[model samples]
Target: MSLTAVETLNREFLEIRCRILDLAAMLDRLERSDDTVADDPRLKRIHEAIDLLTKSASRNSSSDRAEQVQLTFSRPYDSAWLQNLKVRPR
Candidate 1:
């Protein structure tokens, strides 16, 4: 766990948090739109998925803090090797 790894992990976590917030805002916008609510099943499904993701993220974050667990990033460089790399706090 090097400094670089820690920085990267922090960046990734921030990015994920931002994405969750953005999805929530998007869902709010969709719900408030003037279009027929029943017209698009896809939007409904997407909203449901986003809700699930938001809940999961919230749960994970709370548990992580309680247990002092640190989130890390798995390397995406190798297509075949799935378990070779991890980035965590030093």
Candidate 2:
């Protein structure tokens, strides 16, 4: 890729990100409302989009963090067996 290619992509990428966030926030509000949105196809598609984005992000993450998963323990001491506990940049 060249500089011009990047320049062309930057605005589009930012716009897409903004739109996705806005959509997700709207869906979040709907999910929190009293109405039942679980069976909604639109809601399902939103969830799927988020999952796909998360997996893609994980793939691009630094080596210091887990590639595709985040782990948690039941109790504080239950995680003692773990060794690596590094934080990665957002």
Candidate 3:
């Protein structure tokens, strides 16, 4: 991919990660509140948005890291390098 494309994707990934964190904070606040607004349809939408953002952020992070690995290991693969390719479980 072009440098511009990689830059764009990196920015998007950061934005999505930030958004997911923000949504998680908002959900925590709502869950702690005693008011009816906490149980409103808008809150449900926010919850769903959080779930979508979490998945998107995870996929983007993986893709970004994979691209970096490809760039870093452009030469013929070695056994040690292949062993290091496994992503640690989250």
Candidate 4:
């Protein structure tokens, strides 16, 4: 049987909150660091994923936040990738 909405929230809320706190701490560390990573693509992808998380459910019809966040960090598939990387198929 599926969990009721309240039960699901009760079970998952602390974990979710912890993750958010972790992300916030990481961002804070980055901001305080001497090195500049503001122009890095990875940082841009992180911002994109953050935006995805904050988007309203009504604005986004699909409920695949994990997939969306993952895609934000993924490169487009290239058929020649293995050849480019010089990896021989077994």
Q: What is the C-alpha lDDT of each candidate?
A: 0.59, 0.62, 0.63, 0.90
Rank by lDDT, highest first: 4, 3, 2, 1
Which scores greater on TM-score, model 1 or model 2? 2
- Number of clashing residue pairs in every model? 0, 0, 0, 0
Stretches of candidate 2 exceeding 4 Å from the true structure: 1-10, 61-90
Cα lDDT of model 4 by residue, 32-81, tens digit:
99998999988999998898888845586667888888888888899999
- The sequence of per-residue lDDT tens digits that candidate 3 reaches over residues 1-90 is 556877877869888679769967876786787875855765555455445545756786545543454444355667676458875555
For lDDT, the strongest prediction is 4
TM-score versus the correct structure, for each prediction:
0.41, 0.43, 0.38, 0.89
| Residue 4 lDDT in candidate 4 | 94
lDDT of candidate 2 over 1-90, digit per residue (tens): 556757877858989789879977887798789879799876665566567567766787444333222322122444434444554545
Q: Which candidate do you rate higher for lDDT, 2 or 3?
A: 3
In model 1, the Cα lDDT at residue 66 comes to: 19
lDDT of 2 at 45: 57
RMSD of each: 12.8, 13.1, 15.0, 1.6
Top candidate on TM-score is: 4
Report residue 9 deviation for candidate 4 (angstroms). Answer: 0.6
Between candidates 1 and 4, the one scoring higher on TM-score is 4
Winner on TM-score (2 vs 3)? 2
Cα RMSD for predicted model 1: 12.8
What C-alpha lDDT, on a 0 to 100 scale, does residue 70 get in candidate 2? 34
